[model samples]
Target: MKPRTILLSLMSYLAVTATAIAAPEYSVDHGSYNFGTVTQGKKVQHSFTIKNNGDATLQIKQLTASCGCTAATPSASSIAPGKSAEIKVVFDSTNFSGKVQKTVAMTTNAGKNPNYTFTMEGIVAEELQATPRQISLGTMKAGVPREVTVTVRNNGSTMHRLISATANSNSLQITPKIPKQNIKPGESGTVELTIASRSEARILSGYLHIVTDNPQKKEITIPIYGSAAK
Candidate 1:
């Protein structure tokens, strides 16, 4: 072979070798975690293992969580070829109930797959159950006061204490305050909402805010609806 031809072949081989090792590949053990059923105010955590399958190093650019209730952290920001890292995720179940889902996303420098996402899902059970979630007075006579009642049942394994019940708007007044009460497990309590008479008849819209000793749901709001007419 000619010397010039040999030189050209060597250069082509180096070019191909450089291209093979220039890109990175990212992989994970799993993409989702199921927390099953958990009580409110509980904090759940899980760790996901990440691996670099390509020849180059995988650089984690950014990590983000879907909401403030969730937090995501990485053991290491970079993973070399054939190495692994861990991504820790935590989800807070406070102020949440029923079925809930949260997510964590990460950005990387991999060529084919640069973005990855992980999910968490579970059901949150509340200890205190509120009946008649809202108050609907419909239509009332102007200058005539009325009363409304809400029942709170303890459905969990512990007792719940009722702190106070108040109105957010002056149009809907809470007269003759309801004293605090202790609700035992499997028992229920009453929260009476009294509406005061309005001198000027108009549309009424406000919320009845309730304070409780339940850590899971420290504060609850009940929408109030009604109108006064002459």
Candidate 2:
């Protein structure tokens, strides 16, 4: 064969190899969605469109979300070239308040880019609000009492009352220091809690239940965790 013809053939082979290397491509119509504001105890959903813009088929192997409160589903498992599909995402606002953000990940068969992620964000409005939803007692010494306070506020236009407060463990004591039994609109009060451990080296776990007049969240449980050391 002629040297010039051999060079031409080598150039054609390189071009074909480069084209094969860039076959499958994955893309989404939008990378994020914002629900703006959502009501507490309600469920919201949104759909994101996924497109296969390459020469080969795209296969979605798995779909996952950051938390159980969020769920994602793909309309079709495989997408043909130049075709698009929908990924429906649902966010449960139950037991969630204030600003929140969640992510959904998609595992695909696209080469060099097997994982794709999208985010959803929104604000949850609640009639009643609690500060520091989870209370941490940190490390406490045995036989020593540790006191912490939690504030519950009424954010609605109507009046609400603190029906009762109780703790799962006898070692935990709860006291209400509010000026009035009923919490007026936009009013707030604190609940003082004292906990102690009997063993010198032990782990203590309990739940503090607070009952209120709010219909949606009539009762809420706060987790109490502490380690007692010498």
Candidate 3:
């Protein structure tokens, strides 16, 4: 073989090898975790690891959770070439019940694949009522009377009575009829809440709590929301 031809072939092979090594790559050790069964009013945590096998540094541009109940913290703000990092995830199980599924997404600075995803799953007991179970009375147009209701249901088999009712503040009035004691199983009842905004609030809001046999729902405040006409 000619010396010149041999030199050319060697250069070609080097170039191909360099190209293969320069490709950017990233991966998460595990994209999912199973929490199995968790009780209500508790919390759970999991972690995922990522490695950068490419020739460039990797940056996590953003992290978003599907729900506010979940959160995360990663060890690496930016990963060095041929390096790795860890991302920790946390979930609040308060008031959530019966098979919970949540998702979290990570956005990266790597141009090729900018987004990655992960999932968490577990079962929650029905003992916790969770939040937003109550109703809110938002702003009513200045002069209009605001009448909103809070729903109370006996999802459990045990009979319960609304011996008393309450609102977060004195801005509203709530009461349960004395004669209407003992709500049977599977029965749904409403507590009439009357709120006359002493002053025009762009938004009127508060919590309504019902006293009942349900430990989960006992004194649970349901959020109320209404916006007064601007």
Candidate 4:
């Protein structure tokens, strides 16, 4: 091989290596968080550390949340090489219940993998909770009435009232007419759900919507599942 060709090949290799080393890199110390369980209408917050692991500065172009209940903000828009920044994330549990998960995405000017998503997951405990959460009316003969009861407990510090109960399907009915029941704090009350039974046997599936006086949850649903045998 000629010495000229070998020198040119070496120079090209050095140039590629230098370019790769001079690019920015985005590194997250922790990309996921689990907040366990929190009461409804509570706000939870966490901070994630981000570092620039390359020779060039890392620029955070945009930050977005998956839902309006979540908010994210970065302490610095640009991170110096080998330096760290904090990304503060907040989640509001006012409109959430049961198990929930939310995400926050970050767009950066990094050489590789510029886009990243962070996840926050946990459970939200409601102030007024039903014992079974859902009701199974069970299999019964067509045109035979069936009844099931749900116990609503007030775990909060305020009065919990069942304003009204409505069944979505005609196959079910809320007994006791209006179902107006007031539950004192740290007490419990019962709401009766009756399946009125349809003439034609088929799958029975719908939700029992319950209106509550609780501010955090104005309305709650209890899924109903059953079948009427012909």
Best by TM-score: 1
What lDDT does model 2 reach? 0.81
Tens digit of per-residue lDDT, candidate 3, span 1-230: 99999999999999999866664468888799889976565689998898887787788878899999999888977998789988889999876878889898999877578799989897875442323465555445555565555555555556777666666643433343333547776775667656655353655666666666565456655665556567
lDDT of candidates 1 onward, in order: 0.84, 0.81, 0.70, 0.85
Candidate 1: the clashing residue pairs are: none
The predictions' CA RMSDs to the true structure, in order, are 2.9, 6.7, 8.5, 4.8
Estimate the TM-score for candidate 3. Answer: 0.51
Whose TM-score is higher: candidate 1's or candidate 2's?
1
For all predicted structures, in order, the TM-scores are 0.82, 0.61, 0.51, 0.73
Question: Candidate 2 versus the native: TM-score?
Answer: 0.61
Relative to the unseen true structure, what is the C-alpha lDDT of residue 212 in candidate 1, on a scale of 0 to 100?
A: 89
C-alpha lDDT (0 to 100) for residue 192 of candidate 4: 78
Candidate 2 per-residue C-alpha lDDT over 1-230 given as tens digits, one digit per residue, 9 for 90 to 100? 99999999999999999878766678888879999987677788999999998888899999999999999999999899899999999999887888999999999989868899989998998767777688777777776777788788887778888787778854444343434458888888666776776653467677888888788889868888767665
Worst 10 residues of 4 by lDDT: 171-180
Q: How far out, in Å, is residue 40 in model 2?
A: 2.9
Give the per-residue lDDT of model 1 (tens digit) for 134-167: 8788888766778778888887788888898877
lDDT of 4 by residue, 1-230 (tens): 89999999999999999977797897898799999998899899999999999899899999999999999999999999999999999999998789999999999999888999999999998888887888777776765677677788887887878898877876654453334488998888877766766666478777878888887888878888788776
Ranked by lDDT from best down, the candidates are: 4, 1, 2, 3
